[model samples]
Target: MKRVLTEAELKDLLQAQPEWKLQEGKLIREWTFSNFLGSMAFVNRVATIAEEAGHHPDIEIHYNHVVLALISHDAGGITRRDAAMAAKISTELASHTSPKHE
Candidate 1:
């Protein structure tokens, strides 16, 4: 059975996912894009990843900002899986924002 992340575990995870932070007792992260389409595209990509991981997040998307909150209902709190998924999402977001060289 999956287990909830302890304070120590959550701290360690946070060390790796510096871009993510705890907000209102939830693991939260936000990303901003240039336009609505860009935000939608990022949300779609995040949805795909969430589906593949079997872990869904609470998301709030606006014209250029997307906020994600992760928690495990079964575990009744945050878990390592949530942290891992957050890390993956952060990496993808970073790659998406990075300038590409031809």
Candidate 2:
């Protein structure tokens, strides 16, 4: 079973991931895309990453925005797994292309 992160550890992790925020005990990040296609593409990549990691996040999709929320439900809080997943998602985000304005 994974262990929940202590407050100190969480703080360090958050510092390293400026785009992510801790809210209501979950690690959350939001991405803005130029259109629905861009947003869906990001979501698809996230789905694959989450499947490989075996740590799925709660994802919310709007027309041009996607929000990812990660928490270890079994651990009842954030864990190293969540941090790792967030990092992977961030890495994917860096390589993703924004939708072109037509």
Candidate 3:
């Protein structure tokens, strides 16, 4: 099983990933787009990234808003893998042509 991160480690992770937050045992991030189509496009890209990483996040979509929460179920908490996945997602978003938020 994957190793869960310690509180200290999680703190460091949060510092490195300022866009994400720790909430209810999950690492989460949210984004807002200009329209529903933009939101769906972002979600689709996330789907591909999740598949490639094999770490799917719980997703919530509300029109132009989207939220993703990731946790390592096997490890029973946040893990290094989760942090890495978050970094990948951030990197992907960084390359997007349009600003992620409205």
Best by the lDDT measure: 3
Best by TM-score: 3
Candidate 1's C-alpha runs over 4 A off are 98-102
Per-prediction TM-score: 0.88, 0.91, 0.92
Q: Please write out the lDDT profile of model 1 over residues 1-102, one tens digit for every residue.
A: 689888898888888877788877789887778889988888898889999889999999878888889988788889888888888887776777522221
What lDDT does model 1 reach?
A: 0.82
lDDT of candidate 3 over 35-82, digit per residue (tens): 899889999999999999888999999998889898999999999999
Between candidates 1 and 2, name the one with more favorable TM-score. 2
Instruction: List the candidates ranked by TM-score, beginning with the highest.
Output: 3, 2, 1
Off by over 4 Å in 2: 97-102
Q: Give the TM-score of candidate 1.
A: 0.88
RMSD of 2: 3.9
Cα error of candidate 3 at position 42, Å: 0.2
Error of model 2, residue 67, in angstroms: 0.3
**Could you tell which candidate, 2 or 3, scores higher by lDDT?**
3
